[model samples]
Target: MARWPLVPATDAPKNRDPEPPEGEAFPVTSTGLASEQPLRSAAFRWFLAGQSISLAGSAMSPVALAFGVLEVTDSAAWLSAVTTAALVPMVATLLLGGGISDRYRRDIVLRLTSLGAGLTQVGVAILLLTHQHPALLLPLSALNGIFQGLTTPALRGIVSNLAAGRGLQQASSLVASARNATRILGPTTAGLLTASVGGGWAIAADAASFLLAAAFFARMSLPNLPPRTENGPTMLGELREGWSYFSSKPWIWTVTFAFGVFNALNMGVWQILGPVIANETIGAEGWGLVLSARGVGSLLASVVMVKLTVRRPMVPALSSMTLGAVPLILLGVGATTLWLAAAAFVAGVVSEFFTVVWETVWYTHVPERMLSRVGAHDEFWSFVPIPIGQLSTPVLAAAFGTAAVAVTGGGVAAVAMLMPLLVPSLRRIEIKRGGD
Candidate 1:
């Protein structure tokens, strides 16, 4: 694991050249279209498009992996263990993973990581075909987690690099939109595919998505990305430096703390609680519909995200944050009401609007070279609480009752999220054209 050098004082790379006039959607030269839309380059678009399948496959994973584990082992502990096996490695290896991203061309890392994770899916699918133990998916997932840990930071860092200047926000919007769209289709598509063809085959489709991603990434002619820092720290040192940078910025820490809580609780509610909520109150079909509603909200939000620059910093964002609690709060209360479910969907859409704004904030503010490592730091801490929520949700539901648990949880989220608003670092922060 190569470490990071001290962050050089170089400015975020800027592109000032006028893009050749563009008529068609495709760029005629390698320099890219007008600077205003540097991100519209054929390479970046294809890169994003190619990653779409992979994201869809990621969305597909939870269903196949969870249900498969349940089929093989009847205990909730077994299910929890499988997820932990995957998640722990993702966060634990994240900085080293980021360093790897910083070292190689992002496209290369994307290609290898996608192919590697895809192969794990392929292996899991094959074993399922043979009716092998579902626990096998755990190791497969763990390996895939490793690859994803690598890919995530590299991909975003490269995006920051590729999408210089005005297009960064636009590029970020497209990425969010792409992710939202995939979330919409991925599960339903996976569910239908699994129902018709079995989980094994559904997983095989996930495997195939990686092949497409690899192909697309391999063909991209990205700029050479030599490391920015000279001889610096070893890999562990680099990882530490990343943490220093992350901690040094109150803006970074402030936003990360907010999301860490949000993702941890929200993810568990979705992964473990949502299906259970549906099963108890509604049905699988109802679950699909509600989840799809959220997806639709996310999709629509992402599309309009390009123009949603936050002129009013944390104050407005804070108000929205308070409001964002509605859907999840609604989820707790609204499970029995269809209208409430619709409200839940609306909440998801509205919440993501703020999420996109904040994400670009971090991206712009952080140094390009440290993007991956800093990103990994955010990811690591943000997700650390998720497994806690995951393992505990089942127990909480068992003890407190699901509905009560949900209502309480929602209340906690709203209150807990508000604290950051008072923190001077977060309150003092301002949004601008850059991701830093």
Candidate 2:
């Protein structure tokens, strides 16, 4: 293991890079298509291991929770309510969570939040197993959401620390690949556990995964990041600082805005409606296969992204997002399992590609000290509409018909995908090396 010596804020050298000229687009740079494997270091390996364990658990959660809710009451509406309950707090806490990550040791924050999430799930499992009122699960789920929200910014912040300037793209690709691989395994395991033992046991397994992740994270020897240069008077003040930093970069904010709507229409719509369609048209088994195909697509794309490089990354990132609408449209049209699966596979690939490009852009261009807060802003803007979309999609679909809603959402997503390209700054982005 490489020793990470703690450097005090007073001793650390200040960043020497000149800030981009005001009232102009930030200059884009990249590592320019390096095919080297990710750095093999103890800290990086431990961090990756922790993330894999945690993500596997997270992947199982939705399936277990959804089926558990259904077991309690066969109403799709109740399921939505439970999912929304978690999302609301997760979104709400994100800004503050980002600030906290920037202000503290990110790994510690992640450790604590992971522990909280695990315990919260365990509590829910106990409640469910005891045959207590299922309504109790809602508040526990909300508590879990709060921890989930806090985890993101810290995780983002810590990744660069672990990478140690080796290659952010390679690191990001490996992490994405782990997540995608887990998506294939986790849900399938959850389905089996739910069937064989019950939803409670499946959820209990998720709790154990989080505990294991926490243990792995505890072994890391992460470097101490420099303290914030501009400490705000309060949490809100810190958030405003993050916002100022985020908004100053025109390309970043523009893309963030587009994702806000895109996520709403695509992610939100899928979560709310995908299961409904699967239950009605495709059998549950078929839906599982479709989702597995999507995971496979993502896993394959992550592999491609490990080697793929673009001179102008935003072109692919923005253009590829339009593909997200395909599966949604296919589902609305009541397409065959094969057709829906194909479209879903494509959508997943596009989504993963964009994720690599976007993360690489931030890790490369943004100041390391402020990356967590900026990430929070990025996350906040993009995620704000997700819950709204989840809650409202069904209502809108009911009034307008599923086909109309799907097509309209797809149209909006396409527009969002193209709309960012109109910005002169977005069009001009280029990548040289991540964490440059």
By TM-score, the best candidate is: 2
lDDT of 1: 0.69
Task: Report each candidate's C-alpha RMSD, comma-separated, in the order given.
Answer: 7.1, 6.5
Cα lDDT, all candidates? 0.69, 0.79
Clash number by candidate, in order:
12, 7
- Each prediction's TM-score against the native? 0.84, 0.87
lDDT tens digits by residue: candidate 1, 1-436: 2222223345422211121111101121223321336455777777787877778888888776666566556668887887778777877777787877755667788888888988888897888767777667678878977887888788767666556554666777788888888887787787787777777787788888987888888877666744556654567766766776788766567667776777666766666777777776678877767767777887888888777666445656655666555555666774464765586677667777776766665555565567788887777778788878877888988998777766777777676667677765555444554433
lDDT of 2 at 136: 86
